[model samples]
Target: MTVSFRDSIALHANALSLREKRNEILASNIANAATPNFQARDFDFEAELARASGPAASQGSGVDATLGYRVPVNRSLDGNTVELSVEQMEFSENTLRYQTSLAFINRRISGLMTAIKGE
Candidate 1:
């Protein structure tokens, strides 16, 4: 029997990358909340993750192509689509998810180490 280390953690690793990318997008939106005509951008997490994990996926790239402008609940007079409250919420959520993925990867690696050492 053969075990593939990369395959085991690839999902979580891809998720981590996508989450980090998401954080950047949300942070950028928050940073430009006051700028005129700055459209808020985001990617569909589930969709992006699927593409990233697929065989056809280009490693470490494709987030940019998946990015889409977020539609605001209420239009701003200055034409800015970034809603501070929404951006903040999304950022916080993404951060938590990122931490969770990191934790999972850590735990997996720890288990692998234990196995390797036969301890």
Candidate 2:
């Protein structure tokens, strides 16, 4: 397979993994909403993907070594940082992106099969 196709497949796989992690983090945030002094944690998906794929300096050209950071966006009086609205929004967006990535991977596989069969 060509380098571009291979890269595409790899990227999609990374995306799928990232999406799974994001889902878990979001779920955690939602589940902790009721807990007092709970600090909301978030994953930097873009940064994670960059690191997974390659170094921040070489991010565009290849794999980046930058580790994704999890930060709290807001703090509450009781130290609770989980924001229901924000978590829900991120969850929805991540879900959409995951679906898109899956679709692309499936299409690529289909094309490869067609070519292999000389169809």
Candidate 3:
């Protein structure tokens, strides 16, 4: 039987893509932290993953409809909502998760290769 890698690997693939997009959003928040009236934006990773696993998986970037503006704990006089510490923590957490997903994908690929080699 011919096994389709897409079926087995699509979730991790989509997760990596979503994580990359999230990284970009988080970076943007950090970059604009000092700008007046700037708002921090983010998305629900779990929601995006669900969309990616659905029939309409190829619609667009998973974040399109899920993008949300963060509510700041402390509002600034300049109206900027990007909190440096919060953004940094989020970015770090996302990065760690991205690395974990990457490792999982790598392990999956290694197992597939071994199976193909009949070893």
Q: Which segments of candidate 1 are over 4 A away from where they belong? A: 58-65
Q: Over the stretch 1-110, how does candidate 1's per-residue lDDT look in tens digits?
A: 77789878988998998999999989999999999999999989999888888888875564443899899999799999998999999999999999999999999999
User: Clash pairs of candidate 2?
Assistant: 54-63, 54-64, 55-63, 55-64, 55-65
Q: Candidate 3 — which residues are off by over 4 angstroms?
A: 1-3, 59-65
| Stronger candidate by TM-score (1 vs 3) | 1
RMSD of each: 1.7, 4.6, 2.2
* Stronger candidate by lDDT (1 vs 3): 1
TM-score of each: 0.92, 0.78, 0.90
Tens-digit per-residue lDDT, 4-118, candidate 3 = 8877777888889889999999999999999999999999999988887778867444534379999999979999999999999999999999999999999999999999899
What is the lDDT for 26 in model 1?
A: 95
Question: How many angstroms is residue 23 displaced in model 3 relative to the true structure, after the best TM-score fit?
Answer: 0.3
| Candidate 3 TM-score over all chains jointly | 0.90
TM-score of 2: 0.78
User: In model 3, how large is the Cα lDDT of residue 111?
Assistant: 95
